[model samples]
Target: MTRSTWRTRIGFILAAVGSAVGIGNIWRFPWLTAENGGAAFLTVYLLLVVGVGVPGLIGEFVIGRRSNRNPVGAFDELAGRWFRPLGAVALLASTVILSFYSVVGGWILRYTAASTTGAYFTAPQEYFAAIDYGLGAVGFHVLFLAMTVAIVYLGVERGIEVSTTVMVPGIVLLFGALAVWASTLPGAGGGYDFYLSLDVAYLRENLFSVLPAAAGQALFTLSVGAGTMLTYSSYLGEDRSLAADGTLIAVLNTAIGVLAGLVIFPLLFSLGVSPGQGGPGALFVSLAGAFAELPYSRLVGVVFFGVVLLAALSSAISILEVLVAYLVDEHGLSRERATLGTGGLFLVTGSIAALSPAVFALLADTLANVVLTAGLLGFLLFDGWVLGRLAREEYARGAGPIARLFELPWYYAIAVVLPVFLAFTLVTGVGGILGIGISTRGAAAVAVLGVGGAILALRRHGVPG
Candidate 1:
């Protein structure tokens, strides 16, 4: 019997991009910018997306195609037993990610139904506030989880690939229409100015303030740190170039993210709905208000929510696939058993997030950022320290000349510098969680020492790729 492979390069690209360009782009990005410094925030975000995000994405691909297994199996195959914990960490991170991911997907599903029923037309803010925090959200989350489980149980090629093929087109079409409509809204020009207009002085003054947020956005937007990409890449057969494919996937995902902002901000500006008061609820509260008041908005509301639902499902499918692949390949479980087992556990985890808004807030906010950064650091250490020469060889398998040259410098940065930065962010993040402002300089030193310690250990007794 033959092993399963991605149906086509186009399908793989679309599925991968679809996973990246989801709730974070539509539900998170605009608000993060507005919270920090608006246009200046946007400027910083673009820089990180290009400078760090793209290259990091390629690094994940290099791991995946080289190992051709789940994150746990991939690490176990590529490195010695001393590094098994890193693979476990990746699996744990993915599981943690999917928990909150499903909660947000529930929001999209609830909104989709609300759009049809005109639930928000009567009292947009109150409706959103009520449903977003309590039992209503829990129910919708279960619905979303069930849908995701159904697909994963169906197997990857037919379930994930096929649904993503349909969903991606719908997301594009709805966003295009929403952007067009936003331009005609009376006060939308202000939103565009607020979101798009550059503030060079502000950026220069608060560059440090925005760096972590921008970096977080870049990581989340590409879905890089969670091993979703690693899992996807593991199935590759090396028929195509990983570097080129990674670049294209990153570009398309970033483009859609920018487009989501274009559509969302303009509508908020036009409607006189401030994007901040609602926090994460801004997407729902603001859009609901617009639909309730604007001319012919009921029809538009249906289209917009439908679009969001499609995008949410595409991402949810990818999250489930990570675990589904693990169960079948690692444990020799049937696809059905894996899907049900993981999905049931997520229901409990996601319900905790839904019922306890504060927990949900932590999961969606600072805690999530910290976890992802740490997970990425783990992957980098595995690749650059534990798997250095071997990773370079895997990267070279189908890469071109320019990419080939980047192999060494990329190694130095990942092995040495990237981990330091990741550790510093983790400390700052822990500080934020605890409410402190101790010396960032000290944090930087700790980052360097931490990475150095790990590298020395790797050399002495850790896994060999």
Candidate 2:
């Protein structure tokens, strides 16, 4: 059988953009920006996205294209069986993320349907609570999972590439229009001030407190850690610039996120809604209330929620594709069969998350962060150490002069700097998740140094890539 590959370079980029521009962009980015000093957080977040996120994204791309295999097979093929456990970390991240992610996708689907008939406009908070965890949520989760499964079952080039080609452009166009509409609302200037106004004092004083969250959000927005990028890149059949592609994905994702803030914050302020008080349900509740009072309430609600639905479905499709690719490559399962098996697994797991808020929080918030950080850490280490010299060779394969210029430096950063940075973030993030208070800076330093020492020793022993 012929191996599958992306039909065009644009297809791959769009699919990745679709993956990156999901719930994180639409929901979490705005919330984090508001809570962390608005424009100050955005500045730090953009810095991290470039300095760390893009390099890590390139590392995943190199691993995927070099091996042309799923994470487990890629690691085993490139590094040896002993290093395959690192790939397992990625697989684990994908599973944990999609379990709860599908649940949220279901919520978006529910909200989209509700907006058509103004179901939630009466009491948005109560509606969210009622549907947040129950059999109803489980049913919707299954529906969302079904949508994801159907897309993955269509084969890579036909299903994923084609769908994302349409979905990504639609997402950008719709959000752009929403941002313009939102800007015309009464008192929208206050929202702009809050969102774009940088408070240097807040950033200077709260740097440590804000860095980990920013780092985590940077990774999340780019869809780097859970093998989704790796899996997506594995389908490449041509030599395109990985660095160039990674940069574009990061830029577009960040732009849409900022645009989302433009739409969300302004609309909320226009409606006299306090964004900081909305919590996780802010998008649904406050926005729902705003829509209820607006002149073209029903039309606005439909368009707004429809954009989120597209965003959610596109991202869920990418996450589900990772496991399906694994089964197809590693287990020799047919694409349809593999998709069914993966979907079946998620049906049970997602239903659990849908029915139990505690389980959803555990997977989505605590475990997902730790696993994604670990997964990216492992991939970068392999890129820097195991693949070492060869990693650069692969990176330079389809490159222009500009991409070729940074080849060696990219190597060092991915190999040395990023692993250490991610190691620290992983430690602090896990500590936060587990409700433990440790000296975060000290522990992170010790942990990164320990790993660095081990890498140095391994190189001394003459390990081959």
Most accurate candidate by lDDT: 2
lDDT of 1 by residue, 1-465 (tens): 144578888888888988988777888887787777778888888887776777788788878888887777777777755666766766676777778888888988888877777888878778877788688889999999999888877776898888888888788777877788778888888888888898888888766567777777888888888788988888787767787888898888888888888877877777667767768877887788878876677677877887787788788778778777777878888888888999989999999988988888777777667767777888888788777888778878888887778777777777776777777877767766788774768878877888888888886764565
Which runs of model 1 end up more than 4 angstroms from their true locations?
Answer: 1-3, 200-209, 293-296, 462-465
Pairs clashing within candidate 1: none
* Residue range 1-465, candidate 2, lDDT tens digits: 567888888898999999999888887787677667777788889898889999999999999998998989998888667777878888898899899989988888898888889998888778888888899999889998998899889988889889889888988998898788788888999889888888899899887667777887788788888999999888885478888888888889889988888888887778676777655566777678767877878887888788788888888899888888888888899999999999999999999999898898788656776787888888888888888888898898888899999998899999888888888877777767777775866867776786788587546643475
**Candidate 1 versus the native: TM-score?**
0.94
Cα deviation in Å at residue 179, candidate 2?
Answer: 0.9
lDDT of each: 0.80, 0.84
- What TM-score, computed on C-alpha atoms, does each candidate reach? 0.94, 0.95
